[model samples]
Target: MQNRFRANARFGGQRAIVALMLREMSTTYGRSPGGYIWAILSPVAAIAFLSLAFSAFFHTPPIGNSFAMFYATGMVPFLMFNDIQNKVSQSLMYSKQLLAYPKVTFLDALIARFLLNFMTQLLVAYIIFGGTMLFFEGTLSIDILTVLDGLLLAAQLGLGIGTLNCFIYLRFPVWQQMWSVLSRPLFLVSCTMIMFDGIPEPFRDWLWWNPLVHVVGLVREGFYDGYDGYYISSKYVMLVAMVCFALGLLFLRRHHRDLFER
Candidate 1:
């Protein structure tokens, strides 16, 4: 009886997740004309613009011969982290109405949003990176495994931070704006456009704390064979991500009822 009950619970969770995914898709992508195509285009356009603008100023990229590829290496992973984190952070708020149903859990909402956004970002990354490599001449010396590893790290970090933010966001309304203002400098310091090696002085020591820096560094290391990502500490990034994720879950579990009542 217990085994049967477990199976039924698992099946019900899966069903709830699927339903949330469909609802998210319709609400998010359905409103737009192109639906998913805009997901591909938005990143492609940003990458192209950054590549062109930077190429004009600098003769060559920080490491690679192709600016588009160089930027894509950084931008895609960063954007993936950005999109997934934002999506997952908003999951609870978006699905609060559905959570009234006994079978629909907060976990289901979180998973549903994360899965849909992660898959979409993964597809976008493949298309953008593949297109850049194919059109550009020369050897990028791509290591597929290393690249995948970096991307997975990025996604994990996103999930962790996003999970934590979900609780904070609902609890404190002002945090939403505060995080936006504070995180603005992340793009400049995250080792996206600039290599860690190029950073000189005590500032480099401080910037190393940002988990996304480690993520961007590892990703660039994958794309550029010659570039060594000595600064990337996967362990450090994982620690930060895990801590945040755990705290987020704990917070949600303890206070979700209070929040729902409010």
Candidate 2:
């Protein structure tokens, strides 16, 4: 009986997760004129704009095919992380109505938003990858695994930050606004636009501690051999993600009741 009850609980949770994801999807695109087309096109357009802007200044040769490939690998992941973080931060407040339902918890709302963002971002990454290969005739290599690793790392990092943000936003609303303002400069310095290898030695060593830099460098390793020697410790990245995830969960578990009371 206990096992049966546990199974049913798991099934119900999965159902709720799916329902929330669909709800978010409809609200995000269904109401818009172009709907899903905008989600697909937005990233592509950004990649194009960034590629042109960077190429004009840097004059770097194409690593795989065109500048698009280089830019997409870094830009898409970073943008996805940012999008997920923003959405997850706002998820609790946005889904307050849905939370009235007994089965849907605040964490479910976060997971639903993450799922929506993940699916869209994964599609965008593949579209850009396919488009680049088609245009430039670049061969797909084993390094593709690194891209997958980076995606997972980014998701973990986003979840940790998003979960913590949820609690912070509930406890102190001003932090949300402050976080928005502060994240921009941090994004700029995250080595998304430029390769870590391109940075001078002393500065690069100092910046190595930034986990996002490691994430970017790891992704770049799959594309360029030059980045293979870059000093990004994947172990450290994983450790940080684990710590943040644990703390976020603890905070949420302890304060969730208090949050709903407010």
Candidate 3:
């Protein structure tokens, strides 16, 4: 019975995923000099740079008086999405050697990387956001539920986009470079530096098409009681995420063998 249980694909897949996550932790973080500390600090340092660069210009953030708090709200989710997307896109490639084993499926690789990276980002976001509220001189009223929703939506978006890109990267290696270049503009327009309403009318309407704007708005809603972000639509973000994820799963299911061959 014990042996039979291990042979079941569902049971075996879970075990395989856990094992892969453990392997990734050691190889990805455990071997590094700063290890996980860097994960927490990288975003902090980036936020610090943003604060310094912009402080020379604006006396206060468009919405929040504290620039650090404002950017942290936006940057954490954006970074989470970026990190998860990059990590998930490379998941199968990173563990290509291990995929040779029959029990280890590509799904296992995706699941493992998504889980590990999402959890890591969550912890880092919590630490950064919590510390900012505690130490920074600002009034931040946190709605934990809203923050969780924003993070969840960000993770979902990342996983969905990354899953699709994983197959794309496998099929067309040049796409990797192309995507990196394209994503450069995301940081500038992701509402990290400013709020959704802060943008001019036509631009704000156009920017609403980007689901990330909604996620950031939702996050800020939780922080500021007077913040007016009734325009945020969680359903739209979920729909986009679901579509991408469904398409990714469909493509991977159909052409997984071809992906390996390429």
Candidate 4:
């Protein structure tokens, strides 16, 4: 029975993937009052609040008139990562009933959650960007392509971490809670609100080694031309993301059966 079920659990075509993603999306936010609107609004509000708070404390603009823009670029991707991690960590427990279905593999849940968060993040980022550009008359550039590239990198980073966490959650349920506690402070160190250039040389070098910092630096490069002077290693970021992805897949493949039992 287990072998047969595994055989039937391979990823299906685009149509099946789309249907599964939609089902997961609806199940995730549809029961609430605002449903999908809340998903969009919550991140926007958080970014705005963070921008305001930081703007006051720093006593200087973080990114010129584009402080909100800077914050949005970082916040949207970080929130997407956090959301995917949270959703994927609990995916097995939430989809325990659906696991009985032959088509709904453990991977499908992770993929669906990742896709949903990716789409939602992209939508929110664009909306905020567009509104800021129009209303605030912010500086515009032809670097939109770079922004897209950065978004892809962010998505890869999120998907890689989220997939690994799925396996960790299945193997050790306590890891989910532990991860939440550890990730909060790490967000501050991620160079989301502050530019890599702002840090002292020694700490700046250390922050440059962080993959999340590279991701943010890449996004900033797309937004501001001068940002390339900072120390960002896109190759390092990609390598880290790829390593996480490969290890996560191996872990999942080896322990998939264990997930079903738990």
Per-residue lDDT of candidate 3, residues 1-262 (tens digit)? 9878756967889999999999999999999999999999999999889888898898987776777888898899999989999999989899999998999998999999999999999999989998888877457677889889989999999998999998888888899999999999998798977777768889988998898888888888888777878889999998988888888888887987787876
TM-score for each predicted model, relative to the true structure: 0.97, 0.91, 0.95, 0.87
lDDT, candidate 1, 1-262, per-residue tens: 9999999999999999999999989989999899999999988898889989998899998787888888888888899999988888888999999999999989999999999999999999899988999997357788888899899999999999999999999898689889889878877888888888888988889998999998988888888887788888999988988998999999998997688788
Query: Which candidate leads the pack in lDDT?
Result: 1
RMSD of 3: 2.0
**Per-model CA lDDT versus the true structure:** 0.89, 0.77, 0.88, 0.73
* Span of ten consecutive residues with least summed lDDT in model 4: 8-17
Model 1 poorest 10 in a row by lDDT: 136-145
lDDT per residue, candidate 4, 14-46, as tens digits? 444577677876776777889878877887787
134-252: candidate 2 lDDT, tens digit per residue: 77536656377887888778777777778778888888989988998888776667787777777897888877877788777677677665456448787887888778767777888
Superior candidate under TM-score, 1 versus 3? 1
Candidate 4 collision pairs: none
Error of 2 at 113 (Å): 1.9
Give the range of the ten consecutive residues with the poorest summed lDDT in model 2: 58-67
User: What total of clashing residue pairs does each candidate reach?
Assistant: 0, 0, 0, 0
Report how far off residue 56 is in candidate 1 (Å).
Answer: 1.6
